[model samples]
Target: MNFDAFITCAVTGSGQSHKKSDKVPVTPKQIAEACIEAAKEGAAIAHIHVRDPETGAPARDVALYKEVVDRVRSSDTDVILNLTAGMGGDLILGNVESPLPLGNGTDMAGATERVAHVEELLPEICTLDCGTMNFAEADYVMTNTPGMLRAMAARIRDCGVKPEVEVFDTGHLWLCKELVDEGLILNDPVLVQLCMGIPYGAPNDPNSLMAMVNNIPKDWVFSMFTIGRMQLPYVAQAVLTGGNVRVGLEDNIWLEKGVKASNGDLVARANTILSAMNVNILTPAEVRAKLNLKKRG
Candidate 1:
């Protein structure tokens, strides 16, 4: 088992989570506060996603991101920031009969437009989803074409911000390897997030997670996260399989049954779980050094 692990807390996600739990941070102030809280609870990094403050829906607005960044950077708490570049790829299709007219939730955009915040804010790290996949049980899809991946990966590499390539399946891992081979993902200990349990993608089963973990490059520094109920379990599984862990409202919102959790609560629980397993959870500075990450000014 890998005794040293670092936790990444995905502060808020681009999902319909706001509808389910009121604890999901929405406004920039709330998001930044959540990041700080998670860091105080022992998370080394904060994986972030901006949302419409008014409607509590996922958004790709650079201004919103800037506000969140400024707040976090200006704070006393220390945590590596990891903004999500996974937006602008939501494809909501129409009814089975009328597929031509895309649904209203579709927010597709070009590669450059997608990473606008990353280029401007220059967070310590940003995510580059490695492949396209059906998002959930609905008609929604998280579309990340190979060509798009190449472009985004190149941009993030040029920005000098570590690209946390998110791999939801085995094919995504293959594409991540290709990016590393092409020199787009420049970090030596190449970083990846095994985003398991998102429907129509990889399941949150031990066998499937091990398959993905085994395929990861022997040298790559990877983390694993699963959605809903499987989120907490992956913390143990990831550590045992020599991987880092991620938690927060983005993936799961409960500390225990009938108990809604905040970003801090989730990270603390993961911390507790790792500690019990005799795993030394690395701090943000340690994570930076391990991943060769340079924090933005």
Candidate 2:
């Protein structure tokens, strides 16, 4: 079991969670506030995703990202910034009978275009989703081809930023290994996030979680999280399995059945869980040293 772990608060996701809960940050200012709040609540890192201010829709606009990053960097609180490089790979297909043209939600982009924000902002860490898979949406697929992943990884590495490899299944983990072997992901103790319980990917079951955990390179650093009610429980599950923890509005919006959660609430709860277990929560500086990250403005 991991007695020393760090919590990563995914401040906002590229999803419609804002429609479900008003607490989910939409504008760049709101998103920056959420990250600062989480940092104050003991989250070592803030995994951020900016949304359209007017529509609350997920956006990859560099200007929006600049606002969020700028606000966080200018804040009094200190937290490791982790920007999402998982956008621009959505692939929503048409009806099964006629899959000729892609659906409206398809926002695929070239590797360079996808990593443009990362290259520009140069966050301490960015995510690199390792593989492609069908999502819960009937016609949508979270598309990330091998070539695209390699290109993105190379670019992220070139920026002197750590790539938090996101793995949803065993195959994704396998592909991550391949990336490491190819030296595209050159971090000595590679960082990985084992995303669990998201519809069609790896389930939140213990066996499945262990299956993915067992395959991770022993020296590599990995954190685990699941969506909805399971998010809190996975804090313990992840720690007991010798991994770190992640929690925030991105993956789960509810603090309880009837109550909504802000990013701080989720981070606080995860902090309580870890405290009860007598685990040490690492600080942003400690996490940077552990992951060999390059902090930037």
Best-matching candidate per TM-score:
2
| CA deviation > 4 Å runs, candidate 1 | none
| Full-model lDDT, candidate 1 | 0.90
Error of 1 at 93 (Å): 1.9
Per residue, candidate 1 scores C-alpha lDDT tens digits across 1-297 of: 789999999988987787888899999999999999999999999999999989998899999999999999999988999999999998888977787689988899999999989999999999988898985446777889999989998888888888999988899999888888889887478999998888878988889988998898788898989988888988998988999999999988888899999999999899899999999989888988898888765
Error of 2 at 69 (Å): 0.4
* lDDT by candidate, in order shown: 0.90, 0.93
Of candidate 2, the 10-residue stretch with the lowest lDDT total is: 288-297
Q: Give every collision pair in model 2.
A: none
RMSD (CA, Å), candidate 1 to true, equals: 1.0
